[model samples]
Target: MQKLPLTLLLATVATTSAQAEGWYGSAKLNSARQNLSSALLTSPRVNERVDAPDNTKTFTPAFAVGYAFMEGWRLEGEYTMPSSSTFKSYWAPFNANVNSLDTHSQRLMLNGYKDIPLNDWLSFYGMAGVGLARIDSDGYQTNETRRFAGNRRHNFAYSVGLGLDAKVSEKVTLGVGYRYVSMGDVETGYNTFANRITARDEQLKGKLKEQNLFLEARVAF
Candidate 1:
């Protein structure tokens, strides 16, 4: 009788372990918005500070792959590609000109998640991750007709988010989440003083903060 009970316990443990470990893939649609710091552009000729456009909103796409190592813990890798944003600035000097900037961004992140089960069909999760962002910018000054491109910048990035997941089937889940990302300063395309008679090393740069509202579809293998 004792041997039979021990064998049944082992079987139960094995079954639970098998159910907890698997590979998964996910895709998310993101509505992204940015908050930029002041002093985006500068020139020796004009002492006035130029600020980046505020509350820029864009739609972006995201993807991820992960493995569940335990019942409530997982590790994932994610990527986001955002569309170009247009921003304008002005200098109040005599030869006043409207300057335009086009910016694009992409990020790669590795994250860890802790899942809390609320019921048989519902769960909540929290995740935190670190990433690297690649930012590219190009700009032109209308007055001088001078167009310039900045060197692409690779900056450190990080995000934190909370989400709710609804199990649609044995292998499918749907999720909704909110995420906040911190992106460090990046050099803008106007860094060069090509139109000026004197060359200076000062570069134009700005800090970026982003918020994302994302809807996700995930499948377990």
Candidate 2:
């Protein structure tokens, strides 16, 4: 019957409107690995390019405030705290390895998520975000000699992830997820050796990427 179809449609709309709808805040801890593309180090004296190694893993923290506007959609703004990792690079020209070199990053993002209910207390979700990141380095050193000054740069960043969320209470949810993020590029300052300036103090440049596994908790209002 035509009237029966209309009644079912109205019921469906009502059901959707009654689903999760409110503002929420979340906190997350991420086990992150920083992957640096092979960097090129340039200098006038060297007369050739040199390559550097990538970075290691570290833990970082992130926080977000979001609004669940519809049954399965939400938007949030997230901020990731700065985390650092140490790496060593061998400079053939100097004939030594740079020690205690550290790099770190901080990010701010606007993210959107879509969720699908799997059961009464569980849901699966996917998310994507676009943002800005600031990457910094503490320069390079070999033994007691400083070869370059540190530098910082701001770049465009983006991420994508998937996860499962469990509702423990009407107001609390917990989740675990994995995401891949691109933090853009970074560069080091001009070269300096033994407290003296070089004739052509070229810089080192590289691209930065990250893979993160995160655990999070959210509370709705």
Give candidate 1 regions above 4 Å deviation.
Answer: 1-19, 50-52, 91-96, 189-203
Clashes of each: 0, 0
For residues 18-71, could you state the per-residue lDDT of candidate 2 as single tens digits? 357999999999999987775656555453334466568988999999999777
Q: Which TM-score value belongs to model 1?
A: 0.80
Worst 10 residues of 1 by lDDT: 196-205
Distance (Å) between predicted and true CA of 190, model 1? Answer: 4.9
Tens digits of per-residue lDDT, candidate 1, 27-122, equal: 999999876656356566676644445568898999999998767788999998766666666655623666666667889999888887665667
- Model 1 clash pairs are none
Provide the lDDT at 1 for model 1: 78
What is the TM-score of each predicted model, taking all chains together?
A: 0.80, 0.83
